[model samples]
Target: MWDAHMHCHFSGDSDASPESMIASAMDKNLAGICFTDHLDYDYPNEPDAFLLDFESYEKKILSLQQEYDGIFPVNMGIEVGLQPHIADQNRQAVEAHPFDFVIGSSHTCDRLDPYYPSFYEGRTEEAAYRRYFESILENIDTPVDFDVYGHLDYVVRYGPNKNQNYSYEKYADVIDEILIRLIRRDKGIEVNTAGFKYGLCAPNPCPQIIRRYRELGGEILTIGADAHQPEHVGYAFDQIPALLKDCGFNYYTVFTARVPVFYKLPD
Candidate 1:
């Protein structure tokens, strides 16, 4: 399996080196892995916190790609925090780099990240959740660059109730619109398994959303651990193939030079 979304030292929030991450993937017996470090430009509170030094970051991944060519495939990718206003900057970043994949994610709503308590301040959980979904629509409406939308329901992981009161049905009107819009754009979404690590007992967007994406004819599904450490590389991957099969997916996706490559799901 391919762990297409991950972070290392190149990502400001992670201190893990690429070498350590690669070693973990190799140990996990993963078919391949991608270094999709954070590149959230104009991040709140710390503007340059998630910015990348593209020259050096790309250089490191390219070297590993060559060194491990026969042993494992190392792909270079980026996860850009999507917001409506930074659409141009996000596009330029993708256009300027030779990344194999790009994950467009909504890390904030109205310039505030739900990851922080402040984002939840003075708002009902349902209201905040709706705003987050709406922000994703705004990002999609803009000219953003991304191969797939990462962690469709990431905000719930930080919610006060944390999915206890959340359901796809509660937000179906907007969530369906998001899925339909992405399908129309030829974009896809990843089954981010980080939710399990976060104690959600389900992946982000939940199994319901995954099934719904398939029901809507959305086929480009990618699975990722969203790991920032060595041990977490390919975390819980053993469960994914079957989980995806039950979601009506016959195949999973990976990317090379920004092109989707399909692999049959195992029984």
Candidate 2:
């Protein structure tokens, strides 16, 4: 299978080069991989911003694809940090590039970086988590030209403490709203296996939410490793196909030119 979401040096948070990521994915014998470098416009307090160099990035990927032709497909993708007000700006950026896929995410909830310890300060964890989910509801309020919403419950992954206690039942209303909307708009959620590497026993969304998505007729589910470095490419993927089948998904998705291609789950 493919590890659909990953980062490289173009994504400000990762140090790995794009070529290194490709080499590692090939070593793992992955069917393919995508480079979804970060693009978050107007990130609060970030000087350089997570905006990607679309021109140079596309050029580099194209050249690399040429070098590794017929090895394994290296798809060019982008991960946009969604800001509700700047939906148009985000649209323009994705449209300007020849990206095969786009992942809409919310790194800053309520104008604060949840990765920082300050995000959890002065508020109950419950309150913070709710706000983050609510932000996603607003971000996807309009149809973003993205294939899937990356890491549905990403906030829990980086809590000052690894969030081992959170449950989907508690946030059913908002989470359901997010799923219903995505299904309604022909979009989908990604099973980001990075959660396991980050110390959570489950994926970014946990299994409960994945089941809920299926129960509610949300069929478009994608699996990704969300690897930031070479060794982590496709990390935890071996465990995902089984989880997807148990969660009511008969198949998982990948994209090309922003269109999903579903592959059946192993028997």
Q: For residues 140-223, what per-residue lDDT tens digits would candidate 1 score against the true structure?
A: 998877999999999999999999999999999999999999999999999999999999988887999999999999999998
Can you list the residue pairs that collide in candidate 2? none
User: Lowest lDDT 10-mer window, candidate 1?
Assistant: 235-244
Which candidate has the highest TM-score of all?
1
lDDT of each: 0.93, 0.88
Q: Residue pairs in steric clash, candidate 1?
A: none
Per-residue accuracy of model 2 over 1-267 as CA lDDT, tens digit each: 888899998888898998899999989988899889999988989936797888889999888878888878988899998888778989888888899889998888878888888889999888889899999999988546888999999999878665756889889999999999999888899999989998898998899999999999988887788888999999988898888888988898889888889888765
What stretches of model 1 exceed 4 Å from their correct place? none
Per-model RMSD to reference: 0.7, 1.2
